[model samples]
Target chain A: MGKQGNYSFTGHIRPRQIRAGALRLRATFCLGGFSFLAFIVLTITGVLLLFYYQPGDRAFASLSEINSVLPYGGFLRSLHFWAGQLMVISVFLHMVRVVWSRAYRPLRELNWITGVVLFGLTVILDYSGYLLRGGQESGAAATVGQALFTSLPGGKALATVFFGQPSPLNGSTLNMFVWHVFILAGAVGFLQMFHFWRIRRGGGVRPL
Target chain B: MDLIESERPQVPVEVEQSGSQEKLPLIELQVREYIGTFLWLGLLFALTAGLKVPLDSSPKAAAISISKAPWVFGAIQWLLQRWPAWLSGWVLPLLSMSVLLTLPWWGRKVGKTWAWIIFLILSLVWVGLTFVYWSESIN
Candidate 1:
């Protein structure tokens, strides 16, 4: 009682006095943070991939050049491959942690659905990334994975937008690549923004 | 008396803090924590199966092995194999939605553990059906 303590700054004050478990919250947050890190890793490697890698053109030559000649090209490709797989894995683990905690109940349902939407986006993102390359495995993935497209009633028009014009790196494939790399950014942004908004709006899950 | 007393959440903090509360059961631990995790993982795998995400080869190469459907859709895959596509694709989704929607009421009566167990049992059946889908692949 030597000195009366000043009230916490209104700006800095968290409103609720959380005198209980913060570690769980931090752990869940760490899972999400790691997912973001994986995403960043994928993005960096993807961009580096674009430098020596031509999309849809001499698919074999471009890959061969990258593999045989470009500086750290092989490393970049491997990094992209591993990062994509890791991001998918991390996102799955993050969702599991959230659901198991019963954090997705009630007021958080919409956000939970958004989480599902984000999960779909992540799958689509990985799937689309494969298309840009469209090598043998990617080609097999595209064909056998035809179920990736939902209700392709419009078919040709949409396929062009998604797969590009199916030319020698021209038409719909490259355009699709542009959409995948750029427009998909908006969807990912929505995922993070809405996710945090719901948590802030609904407050967090009760500690176990 | 103490066990019955703990039911009232509004009990004075001192009373609620009484050290003699009963611990939850083992299945309670599993149903509550594990079911959701398993269901989601199952769904991820099931979707990969549906898309046939090429485990080994490319379009030029054919899929030589049969793959499982995503775990979430395992139930539907099950019904599709045993029942009909209309039932699996349409009716099954409706039924599952109803289960999830009514979960709170069921949870209230049966408790979360039983509710979780029931849903998990449904999920397990779904996973079983995915194997049937795998058998149909025959390549």
Candidate 2:
């Protein structure tokens, strides 16, 4: 017996005890692990980006300087961008894998639901990041986003709550910066921990 | 496989003992996670090192007429081009999410079918929109 002999950890099992097809890479694609990795990468790169980023009208200019002037700043920005995109892709794939494997049955449903919410957060995180860039693309996205928000039921109030007033010199970009840097990211992290806890309670990965 | 039987997890020891069942410490999983993450980071750096982070001029003076949303929002952007903003922007995404949230309660076949159908439709729309945007740019 190894030192880990029946250690009774919450979310693990002996590697040998997996089902016939369970050990195959296709079963899960290790997406959950990859998504977590992407999040961590994003966090580190995002923090690095903060030093160079100035929200609002100067946001675009700040990004330009970061890409052109700062040491390895472009690299950090690129890493953050790629990590966010990777997180979105992996999280979506993770959900698909879960559904495909029928892993949402019975006691596992809560985790599935949490996963869905996480997907939404991940998208928003990506969107907010783009908006922080304050490029033409981001400006258009913000306009559309505001339109979408206002078009929904109670959307006017919801938009106000989320986006604040859209003044020419308004703090919307700064608001988005806060969300991208802290609130949304923190929420996703918290939800992810809860998600993992739920999975643990439901018993690790479901056998394929 | 019976739903009831499938719901009960198959213990590894009872299932297959092809000498694959090396019960290592949970730390092994953590180690694997770190290695996988590092490799992914290395690949990401290698791939993106030469590629610049795109910042198109600036929004300080650009006209919104030719502006576009990120690729992920391409589907909604297309729908916005074709349909009412509220419908495409608010209703479509919300409806899809609603369906997704409630999917687990549906019967297995029905749930899976709906999921696949929704995923396929949305993905096709997104891809099609990307093509449309690209073609428009080229022209």
Candidate 3:
């Protein structure tokens, strides 16, 4: 009964499951571990990045300050960058692996869809994180994004767009950060609920 | 009229592991087989922990497209970008529904492997275009 296929870490875990040793756990945890690690890094560095990064025209100056004056700002920034990219890559591989395994078959379909939605929200939230920097890159990207959004029927309502209009970058970029942290934050939390619910319904990620 | 003494299931490849012939209880499923699912997803979450996306300071507009959502919605997004969202939403969902409905029926008559192959081929092409021709939209 100590099979490696149908795995479940929830509830009273069996001794045999952990018996696989560090190598298996390490290999298996690489993806899940990275996700947990990146989230921690984001919280820490995101706060640090905020200290020097005030939204508006002064943002570029903040970037310079972080890059120049702030202690290990460059390192922190790089860590944030690396973590975000790594999270995206890991999430994709995770989904693909789930599909090929036919884990979504029958009763688990809801979770698969939930995972898909969660994945999309992650990309959106993560995206807004980089965009809020309001640096030259962030500013330019916002302008283009505004254009793309404005192309939609009611895109101007987004407040992130404008054609030769005063892009919100002239105002406060913290709003973008707030949107990323708050709006999308709630959505991601809901997704986790669905994931757990599905797992419970399907009786731990084991096969049918 | 003894031309054909066929005493075999027409669809040899579609293995129905259910009822008596079921592969037995306490089925085991491996997560390792789902490497793509975990790795990419884990990386995304990991990146949240201060992992850098590693972009140049210049912040090229083109780079945005490279920052993608997931492949699950890539086809939908690709179609949305090319066509109207209404058409993309309604038609795509309908088509998918039709395909799923016919899948079991088709697999029973014509091998399951054949059906899987078709789906696999389609996924490969779509997935290929996703990584290859992906628009560099950062969002």
Candidate 4:
């Protein structure tokens, strides 16, 4: 198991060597890497938040306490918020970079599709995170989202599953809490791993 | 057979390289990543420390005159106010997403420049709408 053990999951994700051209700032602009970095920041802050955050009716109150009472709680929450916003912007920019470089063509097409899906999920995750704030604004946003979901054929059940009976005054719900923290976040994490692996398997970033 | 063919990774074209084409150890890239990570984190911390994220009015507060969507959904909310829910909320977004999802195929069919133009137009429209919504909110 000497050298063979080196061929593990981490090894596959980060190969021993890369094309030197990929190191140039102009080649990829590191937008994808930036986006992933934001994700890592968000995951750390979010888990910390989960320690004090309460879902449903206690949502807003819990957050207020975290903001005012807990040590560095507000800072952590602010970090999570900024990181979330940055991730959305960076992911969109990364997509633009991919299209600009024509990296989505041919062998990398699946990665592009995965990226698009990830983009959609990122936006939805942002929206869901907003709802978790349990403010009047969140309630309004939830209303709009629910309306969009219900407009589809057989979408009433779908809306219920996703929005989970949010009140007009407060959007936080156990249902949305699970989706935001566990389901959507988990899927993004998994897809990102697949995305990075695909890039490596495709012989690293294509040079301009 | 067709599926396998479609999934096949593209073969890299061999080109005569100058002295600069040397491959480097992954640690070099990792070092760059670490630097980038620190820089990015610095910007995030600066933003967090300088600007406070305001909490929305409490749920129990009297009904506010205006309720805004999160900035990310500002574009959709802007449209929803003017257009039918079906159009603004559902069709337009789904249509835009469909266009984005098919961009690689667009590149193949109409050429890369056209595909890039199509993507740019789509991105600008949504981003423009978001800005418009934000400006209106501020005013």
**What lDDT tens digits, residue by residue, belong to model 1 across residues A1-208?**
2222222222112223221232234436445555666676666767777776665544546766776588766656656666566666677667656645555556566676677667657766766665556444454334323332323455556555666544322221566567667777458766766665455445342221
- The per-model DockQ list reads 0.08, 0.34, 0.09, 0.49
Give the per-residue lDDT of model 2 (tens digit) for A24-109: 46757778878887898888888888777898878878888998899888878888888888888889888777877667766777
lDDT of 2 at A76: 85
TM-scores, each model vs. reference: 0.57, 0.81, 0.56, 0.93
Better of 2 and 3 by DockQ: 2
Residue-wise lDDT of candidate 1 within B1-88, one digit each (tens)? 0113333223236523653233333344234334444543354444433442222222234434423333333345456556654565
Clashes of each: 20, 2, 64, 0
Share of native C-alpha contacts between chains A and B (below 8 angstroms) recovered by candidate 1:
0.04
Error of 4 at B88 (Å): 0.7
Regions of model 4 farther than 4 Å from truth: A1-8, A205-208, B1-20
Give, for candidate 2 chain B, the lowest lDDT window spanning 10 residues: B1-10
For candidate 2, lDDT tens digit of each residue in B23-112? 444454555556666777787887578666777546666454554666667667777888998788878878877766766776365766
Q: Which candidate comes out best when scored by TM-score?
A: 4
Cα lDDT tens digits for candidate 4, A43-147: 999999999999898899999999999999899999999999999999999999889989899788889999999999999999999999998888888888888
DockQ sort, best first: 4, 2, 3, 1
Instruction: DockQ for candidate 3, please give it.
Output: 0.09
DockQ value for model 4: 0.49
